[model samples]
Every structure is written in C-alpha cells, then in structure tokens.
Target: MASAEGIFEGRLRELCKQCPPWYKNPSLVRLYLLLIAPMMTTTAWGFDNALTNGLQSIDTFMNNFGNPQGSTLGFFGASMSVGGIIGCIVGGPLNDRFGRRPLISGGALLIVGMVIMQTFSSNFGMFTGGKLLLGFGAFIQQCAASVLVVELVHPKQREALSSFFNTNIYIGFIIGAWITFGTFRMTSQWSWKLPCILQLALPAYQVVMVWFCPESPRWLISKGRIEEGRQILIKYHGNGVEDEIVRVEMEEIMAGIEADKTMIKANWQGLKTVLGTKGNRHRLWICIVTAVGSQALGGSFVAAYLPQILDQVGLTSSKDKTLINGMMTIVNWLTAIIAAFVIPKVKRRTMFLFATAGMTASFIIWTALTAEYVKHGHKGLGIGVVVIIFIYNFFTSMCWVPLVIAYPLENVTTKQRAIFFAITLFSINVSAFCSSYLNPVGLAAIGWRYYLPQCCFNALMIVIIYFTFVETKGLTLEEIAIIYDGKESFEEAVHYVSMELNAKHSEAVSHVEEHTEVKA
Candidate 1:
C-alpha cells in the first residue's frame, strides 16, 4: 500500500489528470456557478460594512439617526456583530441537525426581512435592532455556506474555489461603496435607505436559488445516505463517469465519517467531542486566531472607519471620503481576486505569514504618515496617508482575504466543521465587535494614536500565525487530517478503504471484459 501522503497526492493528481479543466467540462461549469451563490452570501456582510462606513460620512444619515457618536455610534457599529454572536452559537447545532441548504436559504430569507426593516426604520433603536437581526441571519448562512463551498467542489478545484469563497465579499464591498457614493449627495433619507434596501439583492437571490443547488455530499454521507452521496460524487466530481478518483474520495469520506461516528451526536455533547482531542483543539485554536486576526490586524480599522482615517489626514470633504472609499473597494477587489487565483500555487501558512507581516509594516508607515500630515498640515503628506491606506489594503487582500475561511474549513472534520466555523465566527464577531465599538471612541479620543495599538496588534498576529498555523496546500479535506491526527489514525482508514475500492473496481472491470468477449 502507498504511504498516506503518497496515496493522497497520487489520487489528487489522477483526478486532475483525467478530468478536463473546469471550463471544458459542462458539469463542472454548472457546479462552479452553483457553488458561487453560497459563496456570495458573504457579500451581505461586506455590504453592511461598506454601507455603515459610508453612512457615517453622509449628513442625511447622521441627521436621521440624531448624529450618533461615541457609544451610540459604537452600538450602531457593533450591533450586527452582537447578532452574529448569538446566531453563531445556534447555527452550528442547527446545521448539524438540518443540513447546509436549510441554513443557507433560511438565513438569506431572514436577511431580506431585516434589510426591509432597517431600510424603513423610524428611529435609532429601530435601525440598530434591524442591523442586529441582520447580523444574526447573515452569520447563520455564512457559517453553513462557507462549509458547503469547501465540501461540494471537486477536489481538483477545491483549493482555488474554496479560496475564492470569502473574496466574494469584496464584490459586496464594491457594490456598497459605489451605491453609497452615488447616494451620498442626496438630501433625503433615501441616501441611507437605498443602500439598506439594496443589501437585499444578494440574499434575496440566494433565498430564491439555493434550493436549485445540491446538498453537500459530506453532509449526506454523515447522515448515512451513502449511496446518495456516492451519486453526487459521480455526477459532479466524476463528470458522469465512475472515475477512480471519485471512488477514492467517496471511500475517504466514508472512512472519515466512520472514524468520527462517536463524535457525531446531538446537542452540546457533539461540540464537547470536537475539542476532546489534541488535533481538534489545535484546529480550534487556528480557527479562532484566524477569525480574530482577520478583524483586529488593522484591516477593520480602514474597512469600517475609512472616513475617519481620511479625516485625520485633513481630507474632511464627505464627497472625497466617499469617493476614496469607492476607489479603495476597486483596488481591494482587484487584489483579492488575483490572490484567489494564486492561492492554489502557494502554501497556506506562507500566505498568512507574508500577509500579516506586510500589513504590520504598512500600518507602521501609515501611522507615521498620518502623524506627519496632522502636524505639518502638508497636503502631500495627507495624500501619502491615503496611498499608505491603499498599500495596506493591497497587502491584506493578497492573502488574509482569501485564506480566512479556506484555512479553517480545511483543518477540521465535516462532523465538527460547522461547530468549528461557529467558534471561528464567534471569535470574529467578538473581535469585530470590539473593533467596531472601540474604533470610533478610540479614534475620536486619541486621534492617530488609535492606529498605534493596531500596529502592535498586527505585529503580534505575525508571531502567533508563524508559531501556530499549519500548511494545508494541495491536501484533500480527509488527507489534511493526517497533519493534525496521527498518520496511523487517519491514513490507515484511507489505505484500507482505498484497497477495498480498488479491488472491487478491478473485479468489476474483469467481469466487464469477460462479458464483452462472450458477446463478441
């Protein structure tokens, strides 16, 4: 029998070698489009971030909300995350119970209702309440959808496609930024209302269309509908042929499910079992750190508070701030899209390390430029600050943007995936909540010094990522288990399953040959 690593690599290459490229395969192309919708569920989160950031700069919005500042403003910013925290706690158990599609569709349906409520809010409490519910629904869909994208795609396309998943948030960023920029000059409440209503676009589409997509095969197999799971693999991953690679994958998934049967129970006991082992604990740690670092490492500072960051550098015109936000969205999307394509070509750990280190350096320089602009009142220095912000975004989009979801999803079991994702999002929302709640207060109170702490946080992220993050590039979701679980524990199952499947395949082929000879 081949070594576990050797078997994984050989099977992965066989899948790649036999299958036509995605564009050349009609089934793969269809599968890709279906996968993209779940991926696009993330855009709702991005739209809200950009929408609120833009709303902060609009007089009409501020006036409508009574010019919220300090804690009120912090509450407005943090409310969605507050919803996200509660939603995440429930999302995992529900996903395990009902499957991924229900959460994907149901959460989007909920977001559409919440968006309508927020769009027509009569007062501050109404708007904040709407946003809190919006966060609640968004995280539920996001938790399930992120896992579905990782599971549904053919393994040959899994790395690039899964990496492509979170980057769709940039599409939402572009839409929200440009929408707010277009509406920033309006004198009516529609300036904010229009953006809120438009947040419904992606979620509404997801709600209506998600049913058309297939349920995750991993979820199906875990539910003991093994033949149903095998058929999905043959159609999507095998392109209608019972390809060897597809057979191998089905076996691997079955083996993983069998190994994890004890951990697949209902309620809190299921979650307790997730952290019962050292490997799973390490997986949880990476998920938590990635979630927290994605928000705390100076990226959220600019994403949620770009207007204020620009104000510190002496550009106070709402028009200029909105326009710059729009432009930065374009730069970020362009960079993140490029990174998505490049993800399959590099090590996961290396990408995180490089992105965090670069972001730290960029934040340090950004702080210096902001300080100079504030002191000397130099227009050139202010422009330099703007340039540095863009540079920081470029570094962030390069790796962190794409790997945030992909890394954590690749590291855990399907049984534990939704739970781990919940934990990750819990950390993310908490970090985001802190960033959103504190950024306005910190920026207003300490000015440029607010960035000083972010710079320190970014540096610390680099250290933690280096010590804890593992490389998962080019490994199957099942094969990656060997990295955390012992090879004996993980590979033995794959090897045994592989031999059984291969023997059956050979026997079937020999029988077909004999029947053909007899007919001739």
Candidate 2:
C-alpha cells in the first residue's frame, strides 16, 4: 500500500527523471501540488455558476429570491460576467503591477467575503450584490492563477497541468449539480445557503496558501528584478544547480522579453501593439476568438442554463434535471481529464475543427429534438435532446477546458501577455454575458427554437476556426512569438543552445580523459 505522497513522487520521478538533472529532482512534486491549489479556487466560480442555474429551477430558491422571471433570471445569471468584466479591467493591471501571488491572495479574500455576503443577504439586492462580488473575485483570481501556472511550469507539464487546471470547473459543476439536486428536496433556505458556505471554504484556504507561494520569475525579470528572479529561477527550474537548463530557460525568457519589446513596440507599448500592428492583430484576433469561441460558441450556454433549458424542452422535474446535470458534469470532467492528455498529442486546429463540427451537429440535433417535443408532446424527444446536449458538452469540453486560456497565455509575448489576456478575458465575459442574458429570454420567446441561433453560432465558428486560427501546437512560448511577429523563433534558439551545451559537455569529458591519461 503506497502512500498518496509516495505514489505521487514515484509518478513524478518516472515522468521526468531522465530528462535533465533539474527535471530529476524529487521535490518537483511540490510544484505540481502548488499549481493544483489555485485550480480548486477556480472551481468555486464554475460551481456557483452551475448552482445558480440549478437553483433557478429549485422551488425553495425561487420562493426565497422572489422567483425571478425570464429577463430577470437572465440578468442574475449574467451577474458573474458583469463582475468578470470589472475584474478583468482592474485585476489585469493589478496583477502586472503588483505580482501574480498578491492578486491570487486578494482574489481569494474577495471570494471569501462575497460568499459570506451571499449567505447572509436578506434580499434580492443583497444576493445580486453578492453574486457580482463572487464573479469579480473569481475572475481576478482565475486570471492571476492561470497566468501563474502557465509561467511556472515546464512545457510538457503545461499541457497536462493547464488542462487539469480548467478541469476543476467540472468538480465545481458536479458539486453544484449534486448540491442543488440534494437540496432541491429541502424545504428551507439552508438549501441555497449551504452551497454558498461551501463555496467560501476552498478559496478562503487558498488565500493563506498563496501567501507562502513565490512570485512568477518571468514577472520579476520583466520588472528588472534580476537577482530576485534568478533566485526563484534557481529554486524552481535550476533545482539549486544553476546549471545549463536554468541558464538556457532564463536566456530564452529574456530573449522573449526583448522580442516582445521590439514586436510590441519600443517602451513596451503592448496594448497599442496588440490592437495596432497588422500581424499582432492577427494574434489578438485569434486570442479573442479562442476566448469568445470557447465560452460563447463552445456550448457553454447550454451548460449554464441546463435545467431551465431542460424545463423548456419538457424535462421539468428538478430531480431529473439535477440528476442529468450531475451526470453531464461528471462526464464533462472525465472527458476534460482525457483531453488534457490529448492536448499535447493533438494539434490546436484539429481540436477547433472537431469541436466546431461536433457542437454544430449537437445544436442542430438539439434544436430539431426540442421542436419535436414542443409540437408532438413526446417526452422521449426531450430526453433525446438532453443526450445531444451531453455530447455537445463533451466536444466543447475537450478544447474549451484548456485552450480557451492556454492558447492566449502561450501565444502572446511576455510583455503583452497581461494586456492580451485582459482583452481576451474581457471578450470572453462579453460574449458570455450576451449568451447568458439572451438564452433564457430566447427560450421563453421561441422554445427549443432558441437553439437555432446556437446552431448558427456553431456553424459560423467552424468557418472562423478553419480560416483564422493558426496551429499553436508544439510551439514554446518563445517560438509562439515568431509564429506571429519574429524571425528567430524558440525552435531555432533551442537548437543553438543544444549545440552549445553539447560542445561544452564534450570539452569537459575531453579534459577529464586527458588529465586521467597524464596521471597514468
């Protein structure tokens, strides 16, 4: 019986020990654990979002909240997006200026306070306020957390850990679904309040944990704090060796910073560059579309409004809706975990095409099935629609779970990464806000025909993905810059370093052999 820690170390060692001296450190286990902590906090965002959707259908929740109707329900649903918009505006600047760790801690604290607000709210005003707070805090925390993890890890680790980071959404989704399902039968306010309290627990703990965490070395170096940044680099990447890998990665990062300055413009004018230069705009456009496409066109509208969407299609029971939502989230989680492994293996364009094609088919089918249920009064047709929705989630989850954030984080230069990400985050929330606000109202006015618009959205997304988005697969962050802006890319840079290291090693071995012969 191996202890969990022992098993983790065994796996970690098996995965990377042969790569390089630094990669062989058993303490690499700590980086994995450290990266995972912020992910749990992110789950709170997804969990509450799902919880609200489920609670919208819960009799007790509606009764307590005074039964918000179509447009109103939509507004409440969009509260998180509204908060995310604000969080993006403020948090991005704060994160860049202050550092990743502080923003993460601040976000954790904000979420804790917001959850408490929601739990104790005596009226709709209070609850809505709390919801806004939750959205703002979660968005800020997630932005900082995601960027931090992406900056902290090895390229191979990035593929799996990044996907795992987003997969935490499913954990929140499942918890939200089951909590609502379990509490839908409850005749008290505790039903809703209990979930709020549960949301508070994880991020509240993250605040304390993140405080002990180190700042991102890239960020420190970007700020010209070389000595401090080098210490962190040695700690994380060097494993105290201050060896070739550390020197090379640091040079790579510094080169990236220089390239970013040139490409983004001298004086590091990032935002203008992202919006101004023709080539950079291509990159920005892809980042925005990736963010927006993942949220808006990725079947998220279906996930967020599952219960309400089900009721519209005739699966009106909370038990069935909750049960199905729970199952759907569980499937989504497992599929996303699988997608994490698949990420490194598959190309980004392949995922976009697959997701677009599958989602388009799912929406079209769901629309048709819902129309049948509406016209024929056949309950089975509605059940069939739920199955399509599940399939839709699976496809979207594959790419949306990781690349929505990962592509932008990886594609943009270090200098421009924050602004690029902020803009992307802003775009995502805007797209989400529109979807959240419109879905229910559209459902009310047009019935299952609402999916007609979603079907059209997915159809359009397929073409956009096919034509506009370039393949980002297998490119290092530095290499990714050359894809859009530079001439000397990471692949070329790595090759140059590799030759230099081989020469250095050869010199050392030759020196040792000659000294041994002389002694003999």
Predicted model with the maximum lDDT: 1
* Per-prediction tally of clashes: 0, 0
The C-alpha local distance difference test score for the whole of candidate 2 amounts to 0.76
Tens-digit lDDT string for candidate 2 (149-226): 888886547666766677788888888888888888888899878877888778878988886667788889889896
Q: Model 1: which ten-residue window has the lowest total lDDT?
A: 1-10
Q: What is the lDDT of residue 29 in candidate 2?
A: 59
lDDT of 1 by residue, 370-448 (tens): 8887789999999998998899999989888888898899988878888888889889999999999998999899898
TM-score of each: 0.94, 0.88
lDDT of 2 at 453: 69
List where candidate 1 sits over 4 angstroms from the true fold: 1-4, 7-9, 261-272, 495-520
Clashing pairs in 2: none
